[model samples]
Structure formats: C-alpha cells, structure tokens
Target: MDCVVTGGNVKVLAKAVHSLSRIGDELYVEPQEDGLALRSVNSSRSAYACFLFAPLFFSRYTIPSGHAFRCKMAIKSVQAVFRSLASLEKTVEKCHIELEEQKNRLTFTLHCKHGLLKTHNLSFQDSESLQAVFDKDSCANVFRLLVDAVVHFPPSQEEVTVSVSEERMWVRNHVEEEDQSKAMLTELCLASDEFDHFSVQTHNNVTFCLKELRGLLMFAESTGLPISMYFDEPGSPLVLSVTDSVLEGNFVLATLSDDTIFRSLVRTQTPPPPPDDFMNDDIDSYLIAMDTSIAPGPSASGPPTPPLADSLCQKQPAAANHRTRSYIDEKEDDLASSERPPNKKFCSLFFGSVLPPSSQMNTQLVTSQEVLASDSEDD
Candidate 1:
C-alpha cells in the first residue's frame, strides 16, 4: 500500500519515530525523481532497524517492478520529514550564535540550548565590514542573542576572575598621595636656605637639613649688623649671637641628612662719632666748596682728588698732634704731679687764631665761651 505524508503529518511522524526508536535505528532515505521498484522485508523489526542491518540495504530488500511509483512516493515523504528536522536544527544553531568585529580582530561566541558552548577569535582585515554575518540583518540579531546570553549566563565565582593590567598597576603606584608628598618635600628641601628658621619633618624615617647661611648674609647687608650661625647636627640645636657689632642667629632643620651641618659669620665695625672740637656748618660748607673746585674734569686721566682734599681738611686738630704749649704743659704737670704753666698762648691760639677777624666772629666766640662756661657749671 502507498502512503503520502503532508507537512503537519510529517512532523507528527518524526516525533513518533523519535519516541519509539533510538537515533541509530532510524533510516534516512532520499528517493530519486524517476520512479523506482517497491521494496518489502519479511523481518519483524521496523524499517529503521532493518535499514541498518546491512551496509547496503537497497540490495537486501526484495522489490517487484509494478510497485515502483508507490515506493518512490513513500521514500520521498520520509526524506521530506528528515530534511525539515535538519532545517529546524540549522535555524536553532544560527539563532544562538554571535559574532563581533573590532579593529582588526573578529570574535565568535556560540550559545547552545544547554549553555554557553565556545568562543573563537579570527584575524580580520581593517577594510572588511564588521556587520558581515551568515544571514541578512544577522549583526543586529546576533547582538540580541549575545545580550540574552550575558543575561542568562552571568559571571560566577568559578567562571569569572579579574586581574589588573600592567599599565593600571603602574599608574596607581606612581600617583599615590604619599609618593607625591615625598616628591614635593624633596624639591622644597633643595630650594631652601641652610639657616632658615622653619622646620620640615618627613614620616619616612629620613631627615633633611637645609642651610640658611645665604639668608643671614642678606640680613647683614640690609641691617648693617653682623650675624653668625652655628649648627650642631642635622635636625639638632642652633645658636645665635647679637652683641656689639656682631649679630648672630641660628635654627635647626629637622628633615635633612645626618652630619649635614653648616655655619656662617658676618663681621662688622661701629662707625666713629663726630669729634669733640668739630664745627659742623662751617666745615661742611668749606668742604663742599673745596670738593667742587677740586673735582676732576671729564678729560682728566685719573680719579678726582676733591674727596681726598675734603677728608684731609676735615681731620681734627688733635689728629695732627699740634696741641698748644699750655695744654702740653698741663698734661705733663698732671703726669708729674706738679703745678701747670699759666701761659695764655694756648688760650689765645684756640680762641683767636681759629676765629674769623670780624665783630660778629668776636661776638660769636664770646657767646660760645659763655655757653661753654655755663655747660661746665651745670656739669
């Protein structure tokens, strides 16, 4: 008898065979376009089982010539059912698969019905289109499939492990706060003077000492006062002196090298006071006039001699060792414990010779002598 199975009926027959027999027992038969002879076996087993019984089952089955059309039709129906199943399998395979292209690399991921199956990488040329896939619009479709796979198969303790890249590790180490602070401290130490009063301490168990000797030198230049500095050791004690013409100060640098010590001294002298017998305005104008007259012209070969003449003219009378005889006699008598000379020559020379010859000069001398007498009385 001839049997024809249509589309829905073919699916039902495939399911029935799948439930009834194992895959090895099933036979896959494809009939040719031309009509062929009909075949039947006397065996009690199913056709699927009988097909595998011999390596060449076509030769074993007995056929009569009149049944050719019916055999061809039955074989064709069975082949159509297997081919439909194969098509469904291929659709499932393509649905769950995903591919990605980035830069010059291509990646493929296969997500089977059971679980994630495998991943693959391939070399891709730069000019190739990344969207190229097995089917039209497959890129978008595969992207959706990848998203589904990611949602279903999340990272688990056993499946996922994270490792830091070498670049990241280097950046983290270099940008650490403590490391940056240390670098800043080093630069500040190099720029600071050795004797500055400020202190800088670091937590790295290492100390630095900066010398402020240059600061002390500048201070002396500005204030006209000498200063000296002394250091015992790095991060240790310091000393300062400010006596007479010598001024000194020192401090410790608590964050420099051990045995790194420095000391600085600024020597200075006090300026002498104006002479006791000095006449201020009178000598100043005279010295100024002398300075102007003796000033060297631009064509002169050497430095001007006016400054030297002014200095010489301004020297005190006592500096020339030319005291009056009465003053000398008084000093000698005081040394010998004897009576002094009563000569008026010393008084006349000081009171008359140095004074200008004028009525105003005489009046001024008299007033000055009276003022001197009043000062001596007050003393």
Candidate 2:
C-alpha cells in the first residue's frame, strides 16, 4: 500500500521500526508523518537502513548495528555531494554563455574536392549551442586528445575534408606543414561573412557560393601585400577561379566574383583625401622649392656690386677737398713766422751774428725772397 506523508521526520520512523522488530531478524519499515508500520522477515541481518531528512541543512545519523560502517558510508556520501556541487560551481563560473536572436538565417558554402558543399541554416540560437559545446571541459579535453592522437598516427596520404554546420563551416586542411593550419584558420576568420556585407549574397532560401569565393579573394588582396592575381571564369557551374601570390613568396587559392572584382578595382584606385590634412598643392610646391634650394646653384637675381660702386664714387670728391684744406693751413704758419715783431727779429739777428758775414747776408736775402714769393703765390 502506498501512503503519502505530508510532514515527517525520517529518524523518528527508524526508531519506531527498531523498537518493533527483534534483535536478529530482518524487518521492513515504512515511515509516514501520521504513523509508522513495520514487518518482520525470517532472516539475520547486520545492516540497518536509516533515512536522512533535510540532507542539505541537517546531518542525520544512520547507525548500522555496527558503528564503523555507518560512519564510513555517511562520510562518503557527504563528500561525494560536496565534490559534485563544487565541480558544478566551478563549471558555471568559468563559462560565459549568451543567446542572441536573428531575423533571418545565414548559410555558407564551402568548396571541397567533390564540388561545392552547402552549410545548414544558421541562426543566433545555433551559435549559442556551438559555443556551449566548446566550453565544456570534457568536450574540450576530448577534442584535444583526438587532435594529439591524430598527430601521433598520421594518415598515409594527405587529404582534406570540409565540414559545414549550422554555426560555422571549416575545413580539415591536411598540409604537410603544421604552421600553415593557423594561417588557414586566420584566413577563414578574416573571410567570414559577418564582417563584410558585400561578401554575402542571399537569394531565396540559399546563399550563393560565389559570395564565399569573393570573400576569400578580398582577404587575400588585403593581407597578402603586393599580390599577383589571375582570374578564370568558366561557363559551366559558374565557378570562379582565383590565384594569389603572397608577399612571403607563397601562393594562396582564392576565387573571383563581382565583389572581388569591385574590391580589386577599389584598391587599385587612389584613396580619398585624409580627414584633417588633405593634399595641398601649395604645400607640395613649397616643399619642392625647399628641397631644390638646399643644393648649391646660381642665384636667380643678378650679382650685388653696382650699389657698392655708386657709394664709393659719391664719397671721393669730399675726401680730396678735406686733404687740400689741411695743406693750406701748414703754408700759412710759415708766412706768419716771417712777419714776427721787430724787437724779436733784432734779438734773433744779434744771436745769429756769430755766423760768417756771408752766411748772415745769405740768410737775410733768402728770408726776404721767401716772404715776397709767399705773398705773390697767395695772390
């Protein structure tokens, strides 16, 4: 009979069952809030069953007829519960899960050896689930282990496979070099449709394959600097062909589409004016002049000598007249000496009488003649 108990203590029922049963016999005890029932069976049992209530809050004692076994079992159960809860908390803390809503589904097409493979319709909901799967510890560990195992035992022939899911589309790029995988992944992320609107084309329910090809080509052009490109377009299957020569002297396979062509044309054309310092023709001319002037050259204007010559010519006559006036002042002093006072002249003559008469007569005559000549020259 099934009986429902609304409010109960499980330990009280266990006590009731112990009181009703014999020491060596097996008993089945059912507990309820209102009442307790016990039935005895013909068996010798060492184990005693005890039910615990409020497992999270209160600790209940389940004493097996023996003490040691009861203690061990209780500790084990509690430890297990604690460990499980701790693990769950850690998992929740480490993860960041989010959900988004999308108005329309998005899809991608991947080129494989067998031809084009279309991906499933992807919504924002799908992205969330994909992110969660990667976040789980067990899933992440398993994925890593699988990759390690694959490296340890590589396949004989190198083959590539493409996978397309609702969230993302990727390829198993089995190149001989491991370093190339990272480059390939980077290219894929760059070429993703989320970033560039021009690279995505949706008609009806399906996304066109040419759009993905265009994205690849655009990525190559942007990142692979100074690239040589070749385009091949065939009538069948509308396949676009692209070949890119990277800056690193390596080749990348890309595809051509309308978007790719447009991007190529845009890159080929000169960029628009900068926001603040637009190209100024005047500034350019000024810079060119400065550069040209740095080198030694003949002056555009004539030599500077005519003004100096004119200044010298204007000062010559005044300098000559100043010199002539100084000479006239010197000659006047000599004439003044000849006209000294008579007493002073007689004293000088007396002093001069010591000389010979001829010398004295000659001196007087010379003096008189010099005076007459000076007067006549002045006139």
Candidate 3:
C-alpha cells in the first residue's frame, strides 16, 4: 500500500500523530478507502482517542480495492519521522508513505523544498485498527459550543467536572482547588442560546479529564469551529467531537464518578467544600431551590440524535447561531485560609442557564394551588 500527503494535510497528520502519542507508547495506523484512522489508549484505561482524516484530506490516497491496510508502531518512531510538523507546509513538498511488508518497516519519505529529500524507516508489525465503539443514542445530554470557551485550561489541573442543570452547562476543575499552588478553578459556561441543540434527561453532571479534550482543541484551534459534546451520566464515557468539510475526529474519555473523585480527594491534603456547594457554583445552588420547570427534561420525549458517524465522529452544524453580545458574569475565588477535612471530596460547577421569567413561575404555582383547592372542596 502507498499514500501521499501534501499541502496542509501534512500538518493535520502531524497533529494526529502528536495526539496519539499522549495515550500510549504504541500507535495504531489504519488506512481505509475513506481516510486514515489513528488510535491510542492510555495504560490506565481512563482515556481513548481517535483521529480520522478523510480521503479528501489527503492530496493523493491509494490502496488496494476492497481491502484495508493497517500497522502498529511505537509513537516515538512516528514522531521521529514527522519532526518538522510545525513547518511541514513550508519545508515539505510531499510525504510519501509505504509499507514494506517483508522488512516489517513502515518507510516514510519526506520530499522537501529546494530539491532536498529525507527518508525514515519506522518498525511496525501487522495489526488490526483500534476503534472506539459506543452507543451515542444512549447518551442523555448533547450540545455544541465554541472551542475557545473550553481551552482556557489552567496548568496542573487533572480531572474536569461538568455540572449541567435545566438552565445551563458548565465545567470546572475536578481536582480540589484549595491548594495555594494550584490556581482557583477555571469555569467555562455555555448559555442555552449558545447551544444549537441542548438536551438532557436529568440534571446530568459528570467529571472527565482535559487531556484528550485539549488535544482536539489544539488540533482545530485554527479552524475556530464549534465542537460537540455528548454523554449519558456519571460513570459513563464522554465523547468530544469536531467535524470539518472532509475530516473529523473523536476523543472518548472515561468519566469519573463524584464518589470516586471524593474518595480520591480524601487521600489528598486539600479540603473538600460543603456538600451543597460541591461541584456547583453558588448560583447553581439558588436555581436548584426554585421550581424551575418544563425544560431540560425534554430528553425523554425528544427524538434520539443520530448515532455518531460510523460510531466515532458526531456530525454537527457547520455554523452556530450567532449572538451579538456576551457576558463574563462570574469570577472564581481563592480558597479560605482555614482548611477542612482532607478526606471529603471536592467538586465545582458553572452554569450559564437562562432563567425563566418570574411571572411564569408564579403563575404555574398559583394554578397548581387552585386545582388542589377545588379538589379539597369536592371531597
């Protein structure tokens, strides 16, 4: 099998290679008629990431008809060959990839500018492609938001907690932020209006890592496109996906349970917040008390979103609904000088929900009272 990648796609392939390196030392490459599939899974099994580059993404794609080609190589080997990814467009004329089945080496040749040339032989073994298979239809919540909204990640942060209610969706640092060294939790909110389609079965909240999420964000930072997020509930897999005209990518991350996070935090020196305040901002607390109704619960009655493409990529709108204005309403606060128990779990949340009109809530309550009074009199 032989394939050629030129132009900007070389850069795209480079980003894919870098992302797979995050998961494990081993990298799996599969070439189909449509495009190439790259996959990696961490040793801990906490995360799995995949990248798909459509045939159109390549300048020239070739393989035997009715057959797929795949191989496994150390991520270090792949990186060694594509060392000039950052300058591939300017430094490289074309990249020709071929499989030497007899030698068990994947030979990579870099055709460079000014008549320069380079070749690298990366050792590999015949293997099957790795695929992430999950039922998107089982996921209860799905929405789309800007990449900029999320990539504001702080250093030294581990897991990220996503808190969703009827009104809004937001994510904050999953690790306890009480330590002075670590900055206050970074929260990113997505308004109801900001989402092209936001739906949830219950007020679903889950905690996942930012590693894979950051990888995809970095890949398409130049595209400035809206990405899609879909998940079911706590202790389930979360899928973050992005789509372009000819390419798509999916990052499957396993979500940690609130209890699991709490237990882990218990083993740490950081103090845990009050239960009600756990994982949620003070505002999310106020909203939870009110009789907010008739929305966010529509997941039960709504139609199931089409499953992800070939069970990996989730197709989304090309453009999001534009808004003329924006708001930066809340700011995270520093922890108090006094620390609480080290064993209690810690969680934080952000909400950008649009509150219903006060009059509407009052009217609904009044109607319920009137119906109860009539029933009492009849009895």
Best by TM-score: 3
Model 1: how far residue 140 lies from native, Å: 82
lDDT per residue as tens, model 3, 88-200: 77898788888777788888888988888889988887764455445455578887764365556674566677767666877766644246355565667767777877876
Which model scores highest in lDDT?
3
Q: Sorted by TM-score, highest first, which candidate order results?
A: 3, 1, 2
Residue 6 lDDT, candidate 2, scale 0-100: 18
TM-score, per-candidate, Cα-based? 0.13, 0.12, 0.64
- Clashing residue pairs for model 3: 167-353, 266-343, 279-347, 279-348, 279-349
Q: Which parts of model 3 are misplaced by more than 4 Å? A: 65-68, 176-183, 260-379
Error of 2 at 45 (Å): 85
All models: lDDT? 0.21, 0.20, 0.55
Candidate 1 local distance difference test against the native? 0.21
Shift in Å, residue 41, candidate 1: 99
The clash numbers for all candidates, in the given order, read 16, 0, 5
Residue 267, candidate 1: how far off, in angstroms?
A: 41
Model 1 lDDT at residue 340: 14
